[model samples]
Target: MSINVFLFSKSFAQQHTFEVKNGSFVYDGKPIQIHSGEMHYSRVPHEYWRQRLKMIKAMGMNTVTTYVFWNFQETAPGVWNFSGDRDIAKFIKTAQDVGLFVILRPGPYVCAEWEFGGYPWWLQKVPGMHVRTLNQPFLDSCKTYIQHLAAQIKNLQITHGGPIIMVQAENEFGSYVAQRKDIPLEQHKKYALAIKNELVHNGFDVPFFTADATYLFKGGSVEGALPCGNGEDNVDTLKKRVNEFHNGEGPYMVSEFYPGWLDHWGEKFVKVGAKGVVNQTEKYLKNGVSFSYYMIFGGTNFGFTSGANDGDSPIQPDLTSYDYDAPISEAGWATPKFDSLRSLMKKYVTYQIPDVPDAVLVIAINEIKLNKTVDLFNGIVKNIQPVVSDTPKTFEDLNQGFGYVLYRKKFDNAINGTLDLKGLRDYALVYVNGKKVGELNRQVKKFTINIDIPANATLDILVENMGRINYGPNIEKNLKGIISPVMINGKIITGNWNMYKLPFDQVPDLSKQKSSYVAGNPVIYQGAFKLKKVGDTFLDMSNWGKGIVFINGHNLGRYWKVGPQQTLYLPGCWLKKGKNTIQIFEQQNDVKNETISSVTKPVLDKLNLPKE
Candidate 1:
């Protein structure tokens, strides 16, 4: 790094004021240009934050923007966490130490493709709770949360001699819901205004901003804060929208300039090529537009927290790897895009950008073998005390946020016809009398299947909460299990039932099972391998089916045979120098032998998009 960058530091005592004036941000009475990158604090490991921040600086990015995930912070209502990877305060300080300014988006609803749009799962339980709206119950809760969250980093603002210069209201309010005659879009503008007021009233005194796509600025931006656009290619068009929305007090910027798009499970991963992205960056730079790359370094989803996309299209569940085919890979390795863009940035940036750091090393190891198995049929020992109900309850109704829930019932009479799960939250497997009959998935709109109910046969529907919609309407209405009672032959059955919640919070005890298992039943594969040295690796998922993997008890996230994302990133921080345990729970599998191996690279660019 250049000595000039540090010359401005060494002093956090004297506070300075920052303002948005005449199409630009001015600091200390001088026009300060911001070339920022979006990096989520919750997504990356706390230990590697400095490395990623340093990389952002090396890429010639002058600022770093991040969203504070309400869901991640308040895991349950009123219960809070800000330590370790959830520490946004520490993330900001690290950015300042690395000479990068900060733009904080503390969204009560951040549509970052995060689960429930960053809302806590408990919100679904609130009666008459309408999220991202004007409902008093929701807003009152948001207000309290705002006050609490602001108290943590209010002093980090530029006025307090810290790097934070901007904060955002509810994200992308304009494109949040498609226009409907039944529901007015003006309601969103009102909601945006409410969000701005909430931030200001709760001590977020920094300049607040709202971001959306180019044409949606009017509905997204409130009168008090600056309005920013998302896409590239048309600066003049965006400037016009800002002029029309913010009373010509233009401090034009692109808050979410998408260098790459997010990926959903089963679909081919998306990647914006190096040559074009560099060109696009140059266009914005030449026009003197301040912008932040939407996802500069996309990481992992970690647990069963990957959100879904639901609206016009069929449901799209996000894959475990949050590696959005960005400049930095999921494993923190700089890609060709990083190199090319850094080279182009050198020609425009006034400050000396540091040289690109060496790519993080990845160590691949041989396949580890497992001889013992635990089937899910017997894994029922870990399930919660079964709830009996005439009507099946949702995951939230059962006081659960994630994982699978099973509904079992037996019919008194034999029937052969279509079995309808009026509202299946996501994926489910149908079983009758200990035999797999069929399957249904919300992703494909498959909710009914032809089946036979032998006399008094027990019917079981094991449903997985794929993930809640994080970017659109109907977010609150996505109940995990069956929303209503099973309908056979157009009649709702009122019968005795068992509802078992499988949170997968703890691994099921495998030693007590004394019965034989079905060939395609859920298999818990356990293996152990000695590690000579700890480093990063991508566990090959080609040999396995859909399910989650845990190394040393750390949930690495989900994986499927679906192309584009072929490996699960295994961070070395979770590894040890000696014997390490590998545990995997396959939902349904054919692999007789349980084995695993690691690779040095990620499968980010493969296009396996299905044909229409």
Candidate 2:
């Protein structure tokens, strides 16, 4: 059958009448009920998207909702990528294929525990920019993104053949506006209205909605729209909130019913039990309310996509693993929550829910040992590079992300009092002659330290890009790398910085030299292993420092001295049976060069290394 016909047939088969009455949702022109679950395409791999969809369907859910992240699509402004896991078109199509309706939340601002709340970093660079306001540049960009997204899925609408029945505007605008305390209410409402009109003009034909806290919706300031409350766990409270604002007959949906919690660096992993979810779901369903679990399948925040939250204390950016302890695990495995929710759902729906898909096999490979060691710095100084100026530079000027940057300056005078960093925004590791000395961190704000600089000795100061400040009021001015001037004693040292951008993508050329000497910023450490018979094996990187590992030139993510993630899962597809080349770029020069072995278990140990 043709794609359109197939989509039409599938959508028609799962079609159920839904309407708004007096303000409540009506089914077949009558007040009908809903039970939904949430998931994101960017989190789940394309190959496993279908499996997760089936699992959600089995959980007795009639609808599946997802947030269409703008930054994920427009990785860089104007450039769009919709294939693979990012294919929202295919994701919606697959939802229809598996007998589930979809609700698309195309947020130019999706604060879904995502990096920058799904707003692209490029947007921050706009001149005279004030995000989420009536700023012309910001609004214009939002309009373009909405229009581009609409063009991709407009034809596939439920009114056409797709399962996307509703589209949400800005998420929790009232909370941010009110929380900003400094900003006036009138200014906040003006920004909200501008976003609503932008959506309308961008060909968003479906019903428009906004999710807010219970108290915010009751204020009666928002224009004509459907009201939905987030985090309303109590059935009575949710029903009361709906009745108060949405009228007695409106479709009451829990837009963001929190199913699982998130985690940050240096914290214990958080998890919620299956019983609690089932009980809450049952309560909501029995009370005649429709709900959507915020994240039924919380996927990985791969790369630098993780964001942060602000509450009582100041928290930095989020960890890479978004494993929200939801119904579906980050690796796409079905959990006890899935089974409990599924059993409860079967009691309410009449569809034939299929069995859960098989889980991916994660086997532990054997551990190997490193029998060789190499000294990184064993050369005398010759032809010393001169310093140009004594001015300090921020990370923006250097164009670097996470990791470390070194600042070196040569001086003829010997100073021993105290080395002062004019503006040390974050963390720094002090090293003399490639030897460990001491460290300074921003948490304590100690940027000055006493250091003895030997005469004719080249001074080296290494600074680590701990992490970007992801959320809250202080995020606007977050600049990573070395954010300022370097000084020795009380005098400013002038010279070339020889700035190094320690991004993981930088692969060094290891073919130029013998076992003699290599002087460069990113020194490539290479070792060859002759696999007797390689089928599939995990490379144990516990012996080495934090850095990306490449086997035959295949990127394994960033491995640090942090706990829970020491060994990277190397697929058998990337490994060959014989002689394999392994390369590692250590961000810190202090890392001991050790041989890596194959491990059958995941390494989860904390090391006494400097935190980045």
Candidate 3:
């Protein structure tokens, strides 16, 4: 019996061994090429996690890549959640169950176009905090996070018979350093090394790597870690770039090979054709290179978690749908691209790939009438108490992260002129005496508007925190709402102002609220429909103006009439078989019909691109 136990232990110890050696990835003493696809467990419904993994594996991918979002895990300082959708270990184990390896990218700074680049919003509130830096405060917070995260995933490493063979240290840090001229390169390198060290200290025993573009290697690459490239299409350039930095070594890999592009509000939808993607992927496979599709199955951003980008523009917030036009649709259905890629992968893979999972059930519900309507000021605003402040406070100042903030002030005297919202972060709706007169959008660089006021008129400005900038130097100061005071006719409109905190963390109860819809004012429209059956469906919002949709208390995400994205992808897992309730917060009350319909397919490319 003792001899048998010794043999079993030896076999287990020799089961898995993955390492980067001699310019190639050596797995179990043999060279192997890794075909991986990126998918974030946070973006997809937890109920559909297994299905997504199965679909990716069916696409002939032997490995699955995912980013561990710090902000999603640690909601507040010293507070962490690792259950349900935030469960990284379960996600890894599920990948193993589907016969795929795991490559973990646990970014204290994962700029997957995620909110605040996945840094907890409260991180900005930390005293003397300089994010992505070796600043003690930020590093201390990072250490605590790594410690807690290790407790959840440390034992799941490949060294311990887990599927996680490779772990990423910091995500695309060089790109950030290159954009920020204020910080020194050496300092950034030290900061990157510090994070990698913290991961090592916390029991991450797998091979570590740093990913960046070719030019960013100087700033992003750390000693004792392999340097990989991102977005480099040409296999030659990819190999040359890695060899240049790695003492002429050859196990070249592209950590983020984009199959499709990201979408932002007010812009046309970004699409990548199957021919080009197939061509590039063929080159990678033929050349015996390792690569991972940035998103093989792009999922939904769901709720206020969508982020924005500021690439020499004011601010372009990402849409609710992170579909990325990938091979897999947002509703977990396989697309034509998936078939083409799977066919291409079959030629290279030795083992037989499993057939794609059967498509989930999809049902279309006809228009459901909105039976209840309540104005923003008359009803919804009254639900929360306002913070009395002599000066205007930004969202961060009030300790609020996401959603809207209502700024109110009463004037005893009459006034009329151009009102400028100094420091309007993203978007705002201006109202005079419960009437929405005009709006201010940060995306188009519109911050001032002409307004007429009457004596004793109460003014309210509803500012929506569209999203925090996910990339570049601008990420540091992404303070939403009005950061400064209001100005009318070049004069400061100052006094005791009331700032209402509407984080919308919890959906408000409108069951008892009476209907009071005022045209042109933000209204909460509620309705219920009997659903004897429920499945994946899309809520059509093309006829409605900009606002958010909440179904059965789940915040589906924001919608706008601007264009590109007109429907919110509602997962079937969130719906019930009986009655389902949907509440919409329409900003301009521009709905041609006060009702919505659920369709079988998503309407992502319907473009009403804003006329600047």
Candidate 4:
């Protein structure tokens, strides 16, 4: 096997040094300028890294900036994955290979519209864990991650012949204030210094900088480095801000010039006009200011990595499609944004931009009706034990993220009365004696129903974690499963509730069923669809309530009954020519009556199709 080291070396790092002289960026002790753009390698596949870098280079960009999501690296604490698309080192090397210098932002908390601000879920398990603060536990973990990451790329630094020139200390820290305008200067400085010190101690010699909104700087202080903002809409404003901040001593820089925006679950897709981006880029270049577009290419949120945001409105969780209306689409196809930027970039840079790569070929397969079915409740009861509770427990107390939990309790009192669920986060489907009783949805925050029950009968209440709060200021407060207390007839139920965590990662063992097929808890529904050929088709999830869907074992991600996403786009890569097995683990045991359908277009469309 051959190993290449020159791919990591940067031209500026080989012999050139960047300095600030007379308020101007001096490279190799001479006035220097830069044109940069931002993109994430994890968002794009490994095969497309070089092409995207070349695209940026073609856009006349001399520098390519990227954020190293800690969650993507150390998925679990102390566990690191650098292979495949998570290869940050390889990404940097590829950038250098394309004649582009690199800027690295390794954030333990990068709010790049990522889940948990790039912090891994396991971090929340730590005792008394507080993120992005002076918390010792948080700081200790941050230090460990920084040390490990620095070791990987520190040697590749410009001072060490590596492509990385500048390292950002943190990402937009002032956006969370009460007014969305004040920076926690003291806390920000302390944390930045802590990270800077840790990196320096770990042998990272590159200059450090911070990226925030322009007005945020007034609340904080940047002692010995560059401070760039995000609101560089036009060249004149960008120049004025840079001149005011740097006192005309250095080139103006927009750390995050928004090129496009992201979409929430219920919102329509967003697209930023190409003319505006081109005009802005031209203005910045002509004014001699360096800029980095927030996201040149947006990729898939694959798996459970998607996050939600909270503002003044309800929480908005991001959809699986991370097509942020970027230059590069979610499927890695370049749109008009890409070509417009490419043409604009060629005017200033000397590097040759490569042609866009071809899109993945799509193959279509015929749809077939699947009639094979497995009875879910055909089993003998071994131990039908039930506890007593006046009221049920909410999802919060269960400590689960998303999914269903069954609460069974024996009630001896004869009641032909109404049953009231105090805190059903969103929705619930009631069942009595293996029969459908009634349904409730929390959208209106009401889960009341009338049912006649025999005296001392076992009453079972199953609750679903109808999609956790995906966005808004309430995001951090999102807890899966049942959230609050359950009440019956204005009385709270208090008893020992059997809690089941239904996260996809904890696949329950199916071998314990006494019958050839066990139907209820942790049931895996399988159906085979015969297709003459396989091609790209959208799986219409409108029939299915809420559950993760898998095709032939490949996880397509979590699907919800809530719109405006009723269909999931299935790429042909995971499909087979003959028989394809569709498996669903429904949270509601009684939802066996619901049938999922596959359609060619988005299920939410007004086109009426034949229903099976």
Q: Judged by lDDT, which candidate is best?
A: 3
Give the lDDT of residue 55 in candidate 2: 74
Candidates ranked by lDDT: 3, 1, 2, 4
Model 1: how far is 484 from its true place, Å?
Answer: 2.5
The count of backbone overlaps in candidate 1 is: 1
How far residue 236's Cα lies from its native spot in candidate 2, in Å, is 2.8
Q: Pick out the ten consecutive residues of candidate 2 with the lowest summed lDDT.
A: 1-10
- The segments of candidate 1 whose C-alpha lies over 4 angstroms from its true place after superposition are 1-14, 177-187, 381-384, 507-516, 605-612
TM-score per candidate, in order? 0.94, 0.82, 0.96, 0.79
* Cα RMSD for candidates in order: 2.5, 5.2, 3.6, 5.9
The lDDT per prediction is 0.79, 0.64, 0.86, 0.63
Once fitted onto the true fold, the runs of candidate 2 whose alpha carbons sit more than 4 angstroms away are: 1-22, 26-32, 218-222, 247-249, 310-314, 368-390, 399-404, 416-428, 440-450, 456-470, 484-496, 506-545, 549-556, 564-585, 588-612
lDDT of 2 by residue, 242-345 (tens): 66765454567788887787765444556678888888888877776788887887766654555666434344434455657788766666778877888887
**Best by TM-score, which number?**
3
Shift in Å, residue 371, candidate 1: 3.2
The candidate with the higher lDDT, 1 or 3, is: 3
What TM-score quantifies how close candidate 3 is to the native fold?
Answer: 0.96
**Tens digit per residue, CA lDDT, model 4, 513-537:** 4423333432456567776676556
lDDT of 1 by residue, 289-373 (tens): 7889878888888887788888555578887888787887777778888889898888887788887666556799887887667
Candidate 3 local lDDT, residue 477 = 84
